[model samples]
Structure formats: structure tokens, C-alpha cells
Target: MLSADRMRAHLDNARRHLDTARSHTGRVATATGTAAATTGLFTTAVMGESLLATLAATGLGLLVLPTHKARQPEPEKVIERTADGGMLVYTPPAPPSHQGRTAAVLYATPGVGLVGVLIAEWIVPGFHWGEALAVALWSAGTWLLRPARRARHMLVPPLPPVEKVHDLVVQDEPQLYAHPAAQWWAERVAIEGGAAPATVLEDVEKTGESAMRAIIRASIPGEPVPDISVRRLSALMDVPQDLITVGPVPGRGASVQLLTVGQADAAALDPARLWAERIAPLAMPGATITAINLGSMNLSKEDA
Candidate 1:
């Protein structure tokens, strides 16, 4: 029912999962086997093959057994081929942000409760192997659950609502406008350019290699501000005046067209490749409005 390529993909994924589980199980087996053997030596010397020593020897034997195996199961996802020869991958529902924290709390609870019991046992002059086992179990549970919570978050990353126009430009960290430069030209232009109290909306259709455009509808207490100057934006953005441009949008009286342009080398790459690499990943699918942060672009090669 499946193509050869699809079958091969599934098999490859399964093999990778098995390899990871095998690696974890191997480490666990070695550690547990070594601990059990050490316990056997100590107890046999003290009590001479007592019940506790016998149990340690049995656990060591189990760890060395050829038939013993351990494998961790991963969360499931659905993948299907669309009619248009496209791949549609579906991730499971996102886990809560506090999932890892909750797991840590739960795992710590038993250890907290056993603190008094452990103190009482330590008051006696004997080494309590059961207390040691309990502590190790709690530590292992906490450690193992951390990776599981992280994997769940990776499978379904959270997508918060776009609160403002600036959020579209900087998806990862919208709060911080720019890196070292602090080029928050939009806020500056709206205030100093006589366009204070402006409503900015991205012009998704007009965005391309040349410029990233937005419509600014500005107003004062009494009347609407019709236009904002390119020079003002240029000064605010801290870029060359030629890189920034402004125009009037049709049928929008109080709105001014704010166009942000990139460096000269932007048009060197093919449009399709450029869109795929730079633009497509930033735009959300089925989004009605999109933000493009092309103007006054930050180059990695720029000296510090």
C-alpha cells in the first residue's frame, strides 16, 4: 500500500529510534550492573551471603542476561501526502509550558517525604541500601522526565497571537526591536515625524526584493496627519536616506506608504530561492496580514 521510498523512510526512522533507546539502555545496564556487583562484594564480606546479598547478586545476573532489553517510546505524529504532491506533516497538540516544572515537582515530592525517614535511618549505625535505592530512583525519574518534556515541546512549538505590527517583523523576540544597534525606527518615526498615535498595518502584497511596505494612518487630537517624510524615517532608522522611501496609498487619505529597502546585493539571488529561504519561513501560512523587516537590513559581515 506504500511506495518504496515511503517504506524506506519509515524504516530509517524506526532504526534511529531503536539506536537511541539502545544507547540509553546500555548505559543504564552498565551502571546498575556495576552498582549491584559492588553491593554484592560489600554485603558478602559483612554478612556472608545473607538475603540482601542474594538479592544484589540476582539483580546483577539480570543485568548481564542476554535476553534483557529496554526501549523508550516516543510521541506519535501523522504524515500524509497531499493530492498536489506535497507533504503534510501534523504534530501532536502542544504540551503545557509548565510541563517540565510540574514533572520536577512531582519527582521531588517523594524525596522530600523520605527526608525524615532517611534521617531516622542514618541515626542507626548501619548502611541502609534500601534508602540508597530510593534516592537513586528519585534522581533517575527526575533526569529521565526532563528529556521527555523537552521532546514534547519540540514536537509542537507554541504559536502565540501577533499582538502588534512590530511582532510580525521580529517573530522570535518581538520585544527587542534590534540587536546591538537598537534601530527602533518605527516608534521614533511615529512620534517625531508628526505621525504620533499612528495605526500601522503591513502591506503584504507590495512586499518584495525592493522594499518592505507598511501603511501608517496617523492622527492628532483634532485632525488626521496626511503624510510622513522619508528623511524623518531615514534619520530615525539610522540608515542612508536613499534606502528609505515614502508614498501615498490609494484611497487611504490619512495613511502614508512607508517603504523599507535592503542593500544593493539583495537582488543578486534568484527571486524564488530568495523567497524560499528568507521570506517563506517568516510568513505564517493562511495569515491575512504579514510583516516584512527588510529595510535597513543588518549584515553579519558588518564590523562590530
Candidate 2:
């Protein structure tokens, strides 16, 4: 859905709005027809395939349209044009922090009042606002005991559209994109903003088949260090035990490198050909994450 042109976004929105309007008009027409019949204002003899009846039929036709052809609910989101002339459509933001006065006020406003009235009528000696105030204070104090917000941003950009690479894409560089796993791995790796990274769990071991692995830290900062041991091997499903023997490289950002073993050696990089420049760039419309490893992954002649 990524598009450099904001006009295209507007066009897409327009198309969506048009479909919604049509759906609404169809519903209105059906309702109007029903009302007219119920009130006895309209009768069959007077409406027999004449111009008025023809118009009514056309209006009713929209309702009878196949369910599969129905219009989807229009999006409430507005795709605003960004400072960079690019547009940004907001995804769902992380939940609000519940540790502050906000949470206290929320509890005090409802739960405290209700609980206080019940207590006053049954257990407490008094039925007064003062007692309610005291209960609200107690609720607020207990809420403070809960965990605090970590200031995390959960609504990262959506994943790039999974696309079909041309036939020649795999053929031209079998060393990089040959095996079915090559493109699969590339798509995972190309996910911008670090969704694919995890800690290396074990030392690299290989047979003729594959290797085992794990992770240290994941993409989000302050996220718990993942259990990368063999006990939690399923966390890194894409890392086949046969092809890539991933291990910790101390002092690296991710501290992990996927090394090619006998079977994984089939994915060895050949720099003579460049797919990044030669291939289409990944498209992520209105995404906050910058595209990486998208255009080119080969050595230029200058480097050679």
C-alpha cells in the first residue's frame, strides 16, 4: 500500500467513500420502499412496471446485489499529508498508562461511589459523601501498587505487502534466492524496524541437515531477553536447524549471526549481481519504519 504520491492516497480514500455512499443510498431506498408499503401510500396496481415502478425497482436492485459484492465499512482514519510530502495513517496506539491520576480518577468516579454506598448501608455507621471520598482514596492508593507504564510504543508500522518475486528474481541469483527458504528468509529479514531479529540460543552445530539457534534481545527496547535455549527453539521457527547455524557474536547489536552450514550453504551470497538495485524496492505506504535491505544487497563495481 506504500505510495510516494499523496494524490494516490486521496484517490483510494475517495473510492472507498464512494462505495460506502452507494451502500448507504441502497439501504435508504429499501427502507423508503418498505415504509411506503406499510403506510398504504403505495399499491401494486399503480406501480406496475411504469416509470415510477422502474425507478423503485432500480433502487431495490442494490439490496438484492450479492452479499459478496457488498461494500465494506468506510475507514474512520484520516491519512494526513506529512511534513515530507508523504502521508501517514495512524495505526492503533498503545494503551493509555493506568498508573496516574487518570486511573485514580476513573476508579474514584464510579467504583468507589458504588462500593461506599453499599458499605454505608450494611457495615459502616454513616451514609455520607465523606465516606465515599475515603473509599476512593483507598482505591487510588491500591491502584498505585500496580505496575507502572513502560512508555512502550506498540503500534509499529504494519508489515510490508508480501509480493511475488518475478521468476527471474530467484533464477538470476540462486545463491541468494534459490531455495524456497531463500525468498522466505529474505522477506522476514527485510521486515524493517527489526521485527525479525532474536537472540542466538545455542552454539552453532550442524549435520547434513540444519542448525539450532536462539535470541538475546528482540526488536522493542526493554523487552524481556527471550529464552533462546533449545527448550524454546520454536520461537525462531524460520531458522532451520539444517541450513543456518546462528550464534552469538559478542558486542554486536543483535549479537547473532546466521552462518551457512552444508544445507544452508546453498544461500551463499554472490556479489557479482546486485538484486537491490536491479530489483523493485519494497513498498510500505504511510509506514514510519524506513525500508532497509530493500533496493540492493550486492557489491557495486566501485567496491570491487
Candidate 3:
């Protein structure tokens, strides 16, 4: 029977073998694609072997090219001397950093295509400057296609109005100026644990027969924004003075408008009730009536 350590070692070795096999497969696919795309780049008929070698090298080079990986702080290690002159290693365990907001991105080297070109020049016989150029072209193509981290756009369809909404005079009703831009750090955070992969918010346009003009585009900032700031914004939903908007008031109705640009990341704030809570304060004081679905407000110009 194998010990647990031996079993674990076997598993690790298997994983490494699988990884190498996968790497080889990807290189083959990449080389094939390059051959197809670069057929026009070089005179294949004149330099068959050299061109094939160039393409192969270029494809394989891309996967191996080194790029910057997100660096993490190494665990602090302490060495203690024992009574028998033996040294014991101790690693101070610490809680993982609350990186809920930090976004993760897979960065690629832009010039690696050129690296592939150089590699092909060295390995393939009869390789010429033209073939080198093809390698560079293939490298650039691979670099562009490599998947990496990106910002997350948080905008869901305009959510239903917040709870406890009461009809208020249209003139007295204040327009909810867009929340000051927040740097949705979630976009840059690693795209794992069900987190979003991108950010997509835009200006809220004028909709419906109402007279309200476009006030402003509400979006989180590009920089990592603190949750405290967003939480404060949510809290202010109850403050009448903080309410800001523009344009003449439209006809009054029993329904409350929860405006949203319908972007992808819009739902991110739903768990925190950022929109509904904000609308609650602007309703008639002490009046707990607000319309959840006041018919659809067409966001498109053709609906007008």
C-alpha cells in the first residue's frame, strides 16, 4: 500500500504530465493556425521547409514566452534552533487579504511575437528575414488572442423601485443624480469565486413621456473604490437634501421610477440595495406606497 505522501506525489506527477501534454497540443494548434494565416505572408512554394520551421517555432515560442505574473507576498518564515542543534521551520499563518475588490488580469508580453521570429531564424534551415517577419506576425497574433483579466461592468436592468415608495408630487420629487463614480474594484479582482469578468456602465438616457432630461451618467470609478464609499451612498438614500436632479417635473403618478442603464455589472449592488434604498427617501414622507412595475420605460428612441 502506498503512503499518503506517495499518493500525493503520484497525483502531482500525473498533473505535470497532463500539463505538458496540453502544452504540446496548444503549440500544435497554434502552429497550424499560423500556417494557415501566414500562407500569404511568405512565399511558401520557394521556402517550404524553412517556412514550416519558422511557423512551428513561432507558435511554440508564444506559449513559453515569459510574462509578468501577479506577484503575491511570500509567507513569512522563521527558523528556530532546537536543543539538539536542529532547526525547525515555522511559517506565521495570517488571514488572507480581503481582496474582494481587487481585479485580476492575465497580462501577456506584446513583443513575444518578435521573440518567435528570432527563434525560428535560429532553428529552421534557410530561414530568411522574410520568414522572421512571419514569425513576428504570428507572435503578435497570439499575443492579441491570449485571454487575460479585464474590468467588470456592473449594470443590471433598471431594478424595481425600492420598498416603501409613496406617490409624491412630480415637482417635489427629486431626480436621483447618478451616484458619484465609484472605482468598482471588483473589475480588477481575480475573476474567480463567481465574480464578474468585466465592467459596462453608461449614461442614463431620458426615457418615457416624462420631461426629465439627461442628468448624468452614473458609473463606478476606474480605480479601486472602497465599499465604505458605496455603503455611504446607499445610506444617503434616506436623506432628502442629498437628492439631486435636473429638468422640469413631469406628471405625477403612483409609480416610482428606478432608473438603470441596464449594464452587466448593474446587479452587483443589488445585494446591498444601493438603488432601492436611495429611492425610498424621495417618496412622500410617511407614505409607504410606491409602484414596483409602472409599465416599461422604453430605453430606445424608436419607442417614442
Candidate 4:
């Protein structure tokens, strides 16, 4: 299998090639149009060749273009060293990133431009040059106008009512908050686990009471601690509070909560662990990770 670093380098090279091709195709189209107009023979074989060549160049340029991919951390691998110091294996996380809409725009722009040029060159035989220029100007004007209108609509969506329930969760507990469970649980876990107790405590205080309550609730399912904030997990999970109670069990003569779960879970609950696991790995000797392919099947197959 190709390494992540190798894959990234390959994609970068592909992007550069596509960019260069696009530039060359644009130049070809401009030169072809000017030549056809000055020569006054749009129906000739030479004109057809120029038009087709421009389209083919633009198509090839679009075909090789690279799209942006999101970077996702690999799955946690709990490696156990053998006598020879070789490590045991575990499954990695699946890739998470995808191409954005800009890629579609990039692909469509050249294709559409090619079609327009071809139609203009072939259908009109001897249409006035001014009419062709006017059509191009009007199309450009419409494209520019639509995006501006869309931007205005996005800028002013309707706001929710003030009375509606809204919650904000943090990694730490909050002050002036009614939920004692969040504060108690966070401090207890940090102290018992010998995790950074001071930092954990400080996070709880900064997150606010509402956010802390939501974190506690989400962390421990079926444990209704209090009436808090948002309904969606995306909002609830983001509570800045780092501590999460994975489960509760009787330990050391009391019902103590299990603070840590799997390695991935631990990383999610603790910022230090997360940074160490995800970012620190990149610093390791020969450690290089690449994003999964974001292009279409044909591109992926070609790369393979």
C-alpha cells in the first residue's frame, strides 16, 4: 500500500498538472476564437480542429484536477509489545473527509465553457462578432448576479425565539450552576485517576452550568441528571467539559463511575490524551498520514 506521505505528494503533483493544463486550454480557446474571427472562415476543417483541440485540452485538465479532502485521525490501536518488542495490531478508523462543492464548480466551468465555444464556432457560420460578445457578457453578468443574491439570503436567516430552550456545554463544570453531579463527578474522576486535576477543574468552571449538565447527561445515557439544553448530540457532545462518565460501577466500597473507556473514548474526554494520540504520532520517526481519495472512481482507479 502507498504510504500517506506518498499519496499526498502524488495528489499535489496531479493538482499542479491539472492547473497547468487548464491554463494552456484557456489560452488555446482564446487564440482559436481570435484566429477564426480574423480569417472569416469558421466552417473550415482547421477551425473544427482548433475547437475540438480546445475542448479536449479542457476536458483533460478537468479530469486530472484534485479536490480538497478533510483530514481525519486514524483509529486507536492498542498495541501490546511481544518478547521481541513487536507490537500487536488493531483496526484503524475509516477515512472521514470528502470533497467540497468547489470541486464540482471547477469541473463544470471548463466543460460548460468548452460547449459554449464549440456551439459558437459551429452553429452560427457567419454570426456577427458583436452578438457573440454580447451573449458572453450577459452570461457572465447572470452568473455574478445570482451568487450575490444568494450571499444576501445567507447573511440574514430568521433567528429563533429568545424563550426557546438553548444549552451550551463545555469541557469543564460551571459556577452558579445547580447541577452538583457534574462538579462532583469531574473532580472525583480527575483526582482518582491522577489525571490533570487542576486543568480539569478549571475547564468545568469556564464551561458554564448549562453546558456542564449536558455533558454529564450525554456522557451517561439513561441517567437523567437535570433539564438542560439542546436535543441534538452534535450540540450536546461539544460541551467544552472534557470529563465524561463512561459508566458507573461499585468500586472501593462506593458506586464509582468509570471515567475512561476505550483509547478513542479516552482521547475524546481528555484533550491531553487526544493531542498526544493524534498530533504526537505525526512527530514520530517515519510517521506520515494522508487523506483518503476525494475524487471520482475513475480517478481513484487510475491512481491505483
Q: Pick the candidate with the highest lDDT.
A: 1
Per-prediction TM-score: 0.24, 0.18, 0.21, 0.26
Residue 167 miss distance in model 4 (angstroms): 52
Candidates ranked by lDDT: 1, 4, 3, 2
Candidate scoring better on TM-score of 3 and 4: 4
For model 1, the stretches where C-alpha displacement exceeds 4 angstroms are 45-227, 230-252, 256-304
Clashes of 2: 15
Between candidates 1 and 3, the one scoring higher on TM-score is: 1
210-301, model 3: which lDDT tens digit per residue?
Answer: 22112112133443211122223234333232232322112222121122222224344442343343334444334443344547756777
Where is the poorest 10-residue window by lDDT in model 1?
64-73
Ordered from best to worst TM-score, the candidate numbers read: 4, 1, 3, 2
Q: lDDT of each prediction vs. the true structure?
A: 0.46, 0.38, 0.39, 0.43
Model 4 residue 153 distance off true place after TM-score fit, in angstroms: 26
* Model 2: residues with Cα > 4 Å off, grouped in runs: 1-4, 41-304
lDDT (10s digit) by residue, model 1, range 55-131: 45335533433221222234468799999999999977644435444434442343243343334344544566765
Clashing pairs in 1: none
Model 4 regions more than 4 Å off: 1-43, 68-101, 129-131, 134-304
* Cα error of candidate 4 at position 104, Å: 3.8
Query: Tens digit of lDDT per residue, candidate 2, span 216-256?
Result: 33435545433333322223454444443435443344433
- lDDT winner between 3 and 4, please give it: 4
lDDT of 1 at 124: 40
